[model samples]
Target: MSLLSVRSLTRSLAQRRLLAIDELCLADGESCVLTGENGSGKSTLLRILAGIDAPDGGTGCFDGRPFAWRPYPDWLRKQVTYVHQQPYLFHSSVIDNIAYGLRARGVPGAERERRVAEALSWARLNHLLDTPPARLSGGEKQRLALARAWVLRPRLLLLDEPTASLDADSRRQTIELLRTFADAGTTAVIACHDRDVIELAAMRRLDLVDGRIITD
Candidate 1:
C-alpha cells in the first residue's frame, strides 16, 4: 500500500474552487515535485496533504486505512512535517528554534541536545546557534527551518518553496541536504519553480492548473 493516498479530493475557498485532485499516491521513500504557475493551488494541495487543511470531498488514507487529523498519532506525527516558504522562528536563539520540535515531542535533555547539534551541523548553522534567528540572513533562516524539520527524522516531508529565498551557494547546499534526507528513506513533496531543485530531486513532476492536475 502507498504510504500516502488521496482519492477524489476537492476543496473550495471563499466560493472559489481551490483544488480538485482525482487520485494521487506516494509510496514509502518516494519523492514528487509539484510545479505550476501562481494560483494553481499547488500550496493548497500541499497543505491538504500535510493535514493542515481538510478536503471538501474525498478520502485520504495512510497505509490503507483512514487518516485522522485530531490528536495526531505519535508515529504518524513524527513521520510527516511541513516547512512553509516563509518560516517563522520564535523570539529566541537559533538553537531554540531548531530545538522546538524536539521539546514538543517530549525528547529529553541529552537526546534533544544531540539531535539539535546534528541538525545545526547538517544545515551548516553550527556557529550561529546562539544568535537570534531573526538576525540571521534569509538563507540562514531557511536553513534553521529545514533543520527544525530534519531533526525529527520524519518519514515524509512537505516543502513549499524551500530554496526560494536563498543565494546560489545556499540553494545548492539546501538541495544537497534534501537529497541526503531522501536517500535516507524520507519521502518528500516539494513545490518549486527552481529547475535545479526539480532536476536534482528527480521526482515525478505534476502540474496543477486552475485547481486541477493537468495531464501531459
Candidate 2:
C-alpha cells in the first residue's frame, strides 16, 4: 500500500508561487529523491509533505486516509517525521535531545532510556551522550539529529538535504543509515542535491523547476 499520496498539491509564500505538484506517491519501504535548483521549492514541498506547512490547494493522504490540516493528528505525527537540513537542537544534553520525542509521547523512564541508548548507538553518538549538543562538531550534530529522529522509528521519514553539510565520510555514513531505515520498512522522501545521496538512495528521481514537478 502507498504510505503517502499527493494530488495537485500547491503552495505559495508571500504571494509568490512556491510549489505545485500534480501527483506523487510513495509506497511502503520505498525511497524517492526530490531534486531541484536553489529556490525551486524543494524544501517547501518537503515541509508540506511533512505537515509542517499546509498547501494552498489539493489533497494529501497518509495510509489511505485524508490527512488532517488544522492541528495535525497525533497518529499522523507519529507516522511521519521530518529532519531539517540544519537540525535544531534543544539547549540540553545530547541524551536529552535524543530522548525528547519519547518523552513527548509519554514513553516513561525505563523504555525511554533503552530506546534512547539504542538510537545513540545506531547513530554512533553513544559516546557523546553526556556532551552538550552545542559543544559537538558539525558531523556530531548531524548524527545527533539523526539519532533524535531514529528513536521514533517513523514510518514516513522526510529528510531535507541530510548530507549537504557533512564531510565525505560523514555523508557516506548518513546515506548508509538512511538505507538501513528504508530496508527496515521506513518509507523515506529526501530532498537533496548531493550526487552521492541520489546514487545511494536508488530512488525514483523527481526534478522540479520553478515549483512544478517537471520530470520523474
Candidate 3:
C-alpha cells in the first residue's frame, strides 16, 4: 500500500480555486519534488500534506487509515513533520532550538540530549551548540531548521522552498543535506525551484501549473 494517498483534494481561497488534485500517492521511501511557478499553490499543497492546513475538500489516507487531518490530529502531529522555507528558530541557543520539539513531545531528557547530539553532528553544527540561532547565517539557519526537523524522526517530511532565498553556495549545501537525509531513508516531499535539487537520484518531479498537477 502507498504510505500516503490523497483523493480529490481541493482548496479554495476568496471563492477562487487554488488547488484541485484528483489523486496523489506517495510510496514508502519515495521522494518527490513539487515544482511550479509562483502562486501555483505548491506551498499550500505541502502545508496540507504536513497537516499544518486542511484541505477544503477530499480525503487523505496514511498507511491505509482514514487520515482526515482534523479528526486524527494526534497521529499526524506525531508522524508527520514540516519545515518552512524560512523556518523560525526560537529565541534560544542552537541546541535548545533543536531540542524544542522533543521537549514538547515529552521525550526524556537523556534521550533528547542524545538525539540533539546526533542531529548537531550530522548538520556539523556541534561547535555552535550554545550560539544563538538568530546569529546564524542564512545557510546555517537553514541547516539548523533541517537539523531540528531531522531529530524528530518523522515518517514523512514536508519542505517548502527550503533554499529559495539562499546564496548559491548555501543553496548547494542545503540541497546536499536534503539529499543526505533522503539517502538515509526519510520520505521527503520538497517544493523547490532549484535545478540542482531536481537532479537528485530517486527524486520524481511533480509539476503544477495554474493550480493543477500537469506532471507526476
Q: Rank the candidates by lDDT, best first.
A: 3, 2, 1
* Residue 194, candidate 1: C-alpha displacement in angstroms: 0.4
Higher-TM-score candidate of 1 and 2 = 2
Task: Write down the lDDT of every candidate, Cα atoms only.
Answer: 0.85, 0.86, 0.87
lDDT value for model 2 = 0.86
Which sections of candidate 2 miss by over 4 Å?
none
Candidate 1 residue runs with Cα over 4 Å from true position: 69-75
Q: Candidate 2: deviation at residue 68, Å?
A: 3.1
Give each model a TM-score. 0.93, 0.95, 0.95
Q: Give the best candidate by lDDT.
A: 3
* True lDDT of residue 150, candidate 1: 92
Clashing pairs in 1: none
- Superposed by TM-score, candidate 1 places the C-alpha of residue 170 at a distance from the truth, in angstroms, of 1.6
Q: Judge candidate 3 at residue 112 and give its lDDT.
A: 99
> Per-residue lDDT tens digits of candidate 1, residues 138-164?
888888889999999987899999889
lDDT of 1 at 125: 94
Summing lDDT over every window of 10 consecutive residues in candidate 2, give the lowest-scoring window. Answer: 66-75
Residue-by-residue lDDT tens digits, candidate 2, 134-197: 9887778888888888999989889999998788888888887887787787888889998877
